[model samples]
Target: MEQDWTAVGDALRARLDELGMTMTDLATKSGVSLTTVRELVHVLNTRRRQPRTLASLSAALGWPGEHLGSVLRGRPTSEPSGFGSLASVHSELQDLRQRVEALERAVRRTD
Candidate 1:
């Protein structure tokens, strides 16, 4: 099926609003470059992104890992029952990863 990049962009923008997150925040949290995040949020570039990038953004938004991928594929997104717990765990892991990266950077500066 041909994908709908525009719909993906709109959905991403709305999700960011719902989360009270700026594009930069999404980029940082998702580990995606700010320019790519901006492009997606603004619909400035409709080119498809890597699956990993879409999954990262979706995960950062507290969505199922394949939510954005499904959106891009023009399919209805269905969350499996009890997905909330898994999403929460994913969120916690992302937070821990960011913290570890920060700590590593701090240690590197002191070296």
Candidate 2:
């Protein structure tokens, strides 16, 4: 099967937007490096990623573990089923926490 790096990048970017998450957030959440996340998000690398890398990203994105792998292989995968509202609430809380942390850091820096 052929791999479509562009599709992977598009999906990653779109998911990040949909989650209102920055690439840094994804890297932290996925335990993946920011550099790798940037490469994937920007499609800077056309090389195939390890299954574990894709799985980590998928999990961090609140998707099925194989979601990204499927995309890489040009297979169709659906958005996560069930617990959508719960997941959204969780994601929102996480985003809010990150914002608060950033604000706190800014305040600290100004002091």
Candidate 3:
């Protein structure tokens, strides 16, 4: 079955919103370019087929990279291994740390 890119983008956007993040924030966190992040968020046709890009985004989003890649490639992903929430918590913590660091940087700059 063909993968629905629109659905993929919608899901990703929803996840970002749930995490209180923007596409630029996701790009910075995932080490993906802003353009690529924008394209992915908007479901625009772009050359975002690189495995590393997908892997980076998945890792940043706290999703299984392999499963995300499979879905992006229009392949079947296996059932969850029951660690979804744990991973999400971990990701949230990481995001918080990053946010703290950014705030610290801003404070130092003002000093």
Candidate 4:
């Protein structure tokens, strides 16, 4: 395929046109740089936009809350903050498996 820019960049570009705005217009309205706007379009076109790009695009478009996640970032949505947590302290998931089996056995005996 010719890398369907339609699904991404073209769509955004169309929206901008419909709103009577160029990339320059968006940059002017949002107080962002033209270079940043171009980079956002490029990345989104290539399916490489990051969270930071979405944030910038969102702010520029005045999108709030969960906007620009799937549209610009190619994901279902995003968290307001990172959700990663440290895995169990000194307790690998694999290590817990055997221990859990043993505990289950003990509980069964007591029942």
Q: Considering every candidate listed, which one attains the maximal TM-score?
A: 2
Flag regions of model 3 displaced more than 4 Å: 1-3, 46-48, 79-82, 102-111
Superposition TM-score, candidate 4 onto the true structure: 0.43
For candidate 1, the lDDT comes to 0.85
Q: By TM-score, is 2 or 4 better?
A: 2
lDDT of 2: 0.88
Give residue 5's lDDT in candidate 3 (0 to 100). 66
Between candidates 1 and 3, the one scoring higher on TM-score is: 3
Clashing pairs in 2: none
What lDDT does the true structure give each of the candidates? 0.85, 0.88, 0.77, 0.53
Candidate 1 TM-score, C-alpha based: 0.71
Worst 10 residues of 2 by lDDT: 79-88
Listed in order, each prediction's TM-score against the native is 0.71, 0.79, 0.74, 0.43
* Candidate 2 lDDT over residue span 1-111, tens digit each: 799888999999988898878999899999999999999989998786789999999889888899999999999987645654566678889878988999999999999
- In terms of lDDT, the poorest run of 10 residues in model 3 is 1-10
Measured on C-alpha atoms, candidate 3 has an lDDT of 0.77
